[model samples]
Target chain A: MDVRSRNHVTVTGRVGGPVVMLAHGFGCDQNMWRLVVPALERDFTVVLFDHVGSGNSELSAWSPERYSSMDGYAEDVLELCRELALGPVTFVGHSVSAMMGVLAAAREPEAFAGLVLLAPSACFIDDPDTGYRGGFSAADIDELLESLDANYLGWSGAMAPVIMGNPERPELGEELTNSFCRTDPGIARVFARVTFLSDNRRDLSQVRVPTLVAQCSSDAIAPPEVGEFIHAQIPGSRLTTLNATGHCPQLAAPEETAAAIAAFARAAG
Target chain B: MTCGTGGEEGGRERDNGSGPGEEEALFSALLEDSTEDLYEHAPCGFLSTLLDGRIAKANATLLDWLGYRRSDLVGRRHFSDLLTVGGRLYYETHFGPLLRMQGEVSGVALELKAADGSRLPVMVTSKVKTGIDGQPLLIRTTVFEARDRRAYETELLRARREADQERDRLKLLNATLQTTLLPPALANVPGLDVSAYYHIASADEVGGDFYDLFPLATGTWGLFLGDVCGKGATAAAVTSLARYTLRAAAVYDPDPAAVLANLNTVLNHEYNGDDPRFCTVVFGLLTPDADRGGFHIVLASGGHPPALMMRADGTADFLPTPGGQLIGVLPDAHIATATVHLAPGDTLLLYTDGLTEARTAAGGEDRYGDDALLAFIRDLAPSTASDTIGAVRVLLGTFGTGVDDDTAVLAVHVPRAGSEERH
Candidate 1:
């Protein structure tokens, strides 16, 4: 299997420099890290890719069985490192992908140098028994799935012309185009279930590499307390709160986010 | 795009004592209502939320539909708070990022929760209102009621699922029907090794290819292979009629030519309408020849492909029954006959034209012609009936998607004097 083609892996930056692989989460694709790629590539090698069934990756490689759990994506991360033959590279995972990094690094600790968990959460649903305030409740995740179903027709590329029917307003044709974040509704629903319903709180301690947990100042999805929870769980992991506010610090504060990653990568090396 | 700024600049003028122009009077009355009325009582709902989704302002149209007072939402609840839990998550994961990246999103169907706990389906279109320095200021939204469209979409999804299940059932029915048109297993003739195969070209439609072997009289067997013109239900009907007629005709007289002529007479009489149906068939009568220790065979053709004979002496060729016109077209059809002795270690194979007419190359005008099949069989001589059919099956499998029509093959082989084997 050509894992690179399956995951839409792209290698850019200094050829022999230390590699930093960036992984995007559920809704979008490789374009999530486009803002910070330029700054990271100047000094360190940057590897970017879309998860299977997202963005420019080959959609045919997406199977419900293979990608049902976090292990499927974790397995892809390890295969990519082996195929690229980048020795002990740094991995930066956003949102749900942060758990993927933890799962991957735990299985093959030798394949990674360090991990940067940006706006990550060990779990997204609230746990009453454990008294953990990860975030939303289980019923909320079900609601999210229903919302995806309701908008299924709107997500299809064939429906774009129908929805953007206003010719007088050019913005309807330009900005609202379903290009980068448009996922197949069926795939998006599965990913939504996987993202919100999964609990990896116990797996946080399994990450053996030096890790940096970066969270935004204010994110509705992953709040400050959730970030604190992730930081306390990972042993000897450093936690930093960026000045930006949103679930995506890479897009919100690209410069500071890139600087933090570069300093951490150099220290880990 | 501030709310209600469209066409609200009409000047209020006092009516003169004398009759003024009728058009001017009507135009003045329409615009005199003021922008506040247009914003508050418009048919569609409108809102302006801050960048962080806190609602700064909302029109009366939306607040009225949600059964909320103006103070309940303005400067208090976020735009997402108006959505159901699922819609809120959809907003965070998909809709928010899309708006931030693309600057606008339109016609996103979502359900809003009212204070009364009723779900109001609505279509939302939001745009980012940029400041003078190209900095994001706030989001302007327009919401339209979409109850009818939502109901239609739900019905569409249900109909689509039923259509999918209906197609699957049709395929199963077609497969079962196809089975009934052919014998489950060939008749186990004594002192003969026999093998047969049918390759269906489609799963959704029953094919017309059929073959059977049955006992005709004492110490004799009657067998036939044929293909009806066209396909599906109409051709399947003709195939069923042809198969039964051949069996009945052979029982009256065991002569191969006489059996085929009788079939032609019956088909011509039954289907002599404006749209006549026809088929190509070959009938053969097999009888044990005690003097030669083999079976004596007399075969008749009705515009069907010639049968292939692999002799025991390591040579193979087609038994050409030329001038065999198609059956059921004329009052008296011309049937062609040929005789061959099926000695020990010799094999005779019957087949339809699907094998010779199959395409051999992808997107190329190359077909698996008769010459290719002949060359293949020439090298396959001195083999038993089972081995011959097995090799032919392997050859057909190699063609892959190139074989586009239904095909059937039946082989009869006589084992060596000491073997007494079944193929």
Candidate 2:
């Protein structure tokens, strides 16, 4: 099968404009960028795709050995870029996808023009000796994994609203919950493990592309410290803190997220 | 009473005194009594937390379950303090953020650390209470005891783990049994180089492919490669019977065709009725020719793929042995024979159909047919026995999961003198 179709790539906006690829985080599909895509589509070509085993992407394309690490996911992104003939494109990644962007850009610097990382965290588990707080400890991650395994439906119902962080619009939370439930549970468990257990602190230094670290003000997933750390590690990278609260700035505060990405893209150009 | 309209009037007055007014008084009293009492002694625990997850209010039922007094929790500790270490971590990372974002979270499983150092399993549901201005004010949480549910979940997990272990054990047993069916190593012929390989597609089930190269007597060797009709225990039975019978038969009569004829008769007699088992096999008897400095090989085929012979002069082709019927199928079966002299630097290759029948492409529509094998052999002509088998192994690895059937290959070659030393 063609790599573009396998990843379910969808293109929109100016036909020959600078490409802007948007990648969603874990537990979400490309639809998560519905709010943010409209703002970027007018000036730049917007490329959106679901990760394999999520959304409309072919589940058969998901091999355990192939996608066992973040590197494998990065390979998929590079493959998509190569197949689409996208040259030095702006890559916008949210949450776990932020690390995916980093890994891809580091491997093939010529494939990326710039990177916009939304609420990115290089590591999740807290290291006492190193004093790096990714928020949860190892045991807490285990409990979360166990909870997911025990009743993924219940976990999705409980977590989706919290992750979306727009309590005023209960419908938004409901939609996110439905999306979470729609994901295959077996794939979700493996994805969850890969997301939480990954430590890409060493990989941050290798990013050669001009990057923007857009941190949410009160994100429980990736705190301000993590964003600062990423900004410091990447050479010639900018950091912008959005007033938006929660882990998902694109969902809760799309305008600010898009404005930051646009500003970074313009500055890079 | 006497001044009224006697007995009828008196009875109506008595009913009016107790009917509506008395019932209203009693219902009001019950409502007033239960309101505060119900909140304190409700079936589930109730608590309210500030935006920062600090305990602002807690009910008596929750306090009782954790062996904590109201004074100890309220204004003194955060809601996360009551949770176990792991639960606390989960609460801080997942639950806290979710409640803030979604405004509500339900049926979250957690364990609370009791005052006496015991753990209490609970299911928590929390909702954000918004003010009139649409701002989240505080979190209202309800905790339900989940002891029974937790126990059931634990038992289920244990059963699943046990089943996985049992499957692993069965796989180990099958692997050990499979190893016993094949020869440990091919017997080293005096003047020829020999090599063999067996590829197993799956470890869970035992495949019926078998091969053996053993010395029959002084200066003669009996070799065979075959695949049984099915897999698992049934095919394993046929494979064992065929291997032993071929060796015993070849010892009695050294001719390749006569040896296969004996095997056919034995299998047809043993499994002649319903549930008859069968196999496709190639049997070879080798004798050294002193004058040519090579071996004379006579091969008999029973519905097997034709053997490929790569000659010393950079040429490779199949030695045809046609019209052979599958062993153990009928009362009498045809066993085709072919005689070939393995001159110096010539290799004879015998393999089952698994290699040819493997899917060659991702779509799985095309098989690695006989023509592809023939082309491959022609390219690899003048190859040593070890080199040919090594190349086939590498080629099979490229097939990945597409090679669904077990494959066995046996090769014997007469090495060119003084070019390479024999091991």
Candidate 3:
């Protein structure tokens, strides 16, 4: 059934079949699952939608204060599920959304059957006392922010290579640069602060679902240690490492990522 | 000739009468020559140091800047004696070595301690004097007030730090904001495998490639992927507006072409002035056709690159939906639509131009174009949606730094019957 979401949440797939939900990471949207959906549609129902401020979603639904925290996003997820009667869903999230899914599943564990997280980051800022690796220091973050404000396009252009760092066939930097240049500076500014500065390590313990954490071995943004931390914190969570160096493994190693998901889904079933 | 002779005679007579005047002129010349000497005593103190790093001569200008008297430095104390501890160390370690090697060192920044214990910033230049035998005799040093330079340097450093902090805040804000522009994840539709990948060429900021596949009506899905022109705040604003408008408009009417038309109208109207915004997009409606046991996809394009059709037989080609115009350019846009039957084992790929146009190398000469993409898929025939996207994802990874543009790829595949539902 069609339902209205404050965030323009649209429902798809079989209404009565088991619901499978997907979420993208920082700098991406729900479309990351396009390659995985067709194969999934064979047995279960699927539900896909952008976050409130995400792709093809309601821009007005974005409030800096509201989106600053993932609680509102979790609420939107729960509300969308309720509206579509897509209960007992298998929540699959990428990057920051992994923590977001944790937040949602924690609030309504009964609403979800399992969670598959791809390249998840619980905390992106370092905590020396806790031994957490966030890649850059607070000073570095300050420098990065200044760079962004000074010239958003320039900063994005410079960062493309770092974001798409792959040892072999390293040409995705241009793609990242173009992407950075295509976005509005204001939106990019806000999104940069939210993705890098916001830390949500404490939220991992709250997850109680059958969680599968897929991590990239050489991700500069969210290193391997982070995946281990998430797996350690989230009780009964399984961790698998993909031999990729990029921040977005699904885009870099889709076959391995899909295989992992397929294997995990089967194991869960 | 008579007038010249008379003038010469008159000049000679004048000259004869001007001996006293000549003497007075000489006296005046002497007085005028002493002006530099007078400068030494004219309120400001001055001083010069010898080549051996000792005070050889000093004037009032030098004494004033250092808050010292001539008796305290000239022929009495070494020039380094008036320096602060740090300044003396710096002079000995760095300044002395450089000056000795260079023969002359100008504007050597240093700090001096005053008699009253206050610090004085000064720029000093010193040159070595040599005798006729080419033997070094002494050093002559000049000092300039450096309070302003010090202040300026301090201000510059402060500004740099502030700018860095501001950039960091923006980066985080940009990251989060960028996240909001796309879905956290696209759900796996039952009976079909799906995979999508968005390649952002940058991370210090945001990009304008947007895509989504969300539930619309009963047993149907709505999905779209598009690229907005330009970057920074303006492009981001348009991106947000377009993303939301498309989703909202789709909810209003789930028709792929109509949804794009609605988006086109909103963007054109909202950003219709000078410095207007526009974008290339492809919108699709996926409904499970029980007759096909897959999906009936109505794909629409708005000046966007065509979606690739990777058939179950392993043939991949651009789904020809040409003649579409860019959204937000005109009041009314022609959105091209195409209907396709997604059979089991069929995979459809939608992507932004960033993928096709991305440079295959640092020089950006070799592009991963339509033919190359088709050839690539030809090798991976009979691929599932996830598999196809996974392969493309690897391709994106392989492109590495060459793919300078942000690419958004949305792939939908119809899984074959009797395939393992799980795992």
Best by DockQ: 1
Q: After superposition, how far is residue A45 of candidate 2 from its true place, in Å?
A: 2.3
User: Where does candidate 1 stray beyond 4 Å?
Assistant: A157-186, A243-246, A250-269, B1-20, B33-37, B69-71, B131-137, B175-203, B210-226, B233-276, B281-301, B305-322, B325-423
Query: Would candidate 2 be rated incorrect, acceptable, medium or high by CAPRI criteria?
Result: incorrect
lDDT of each: 0.86, 0.84, 0.72
Model 3, position B41: C-alpha lDDT score: 63
lDDT of 1 by residue, B105-126 (tens): 7778899999999999999999
Best by lDDT: 1
Across residues B282-316, which tens digit of lDDT does each residue of candidate 3 receive? 99898898986888999999999888888878777
- Alpha carbon deviation, residue B359, candidate 1 (Å): 7.2
- Overall local distance difference test of candidate 1: 0.86
Greater-lDDT candidate between 1 and 2: 1
Model 1 per-residue lDDT at A90: 90
TM-score of 3: 0.49
Per-residue alpha-carbon lDDT of candidate 3 for residues A1-269, written as tens digits (9 for 90 to 100)? 13354444545655576667777665445555655666666655767777656545556666777676667667777887787675688877877777778888999998888898888887777889977886556554554444333333233333333322254644544443343234344554465566667787887888878999888875545678888888998999999898754455554456677677766765664
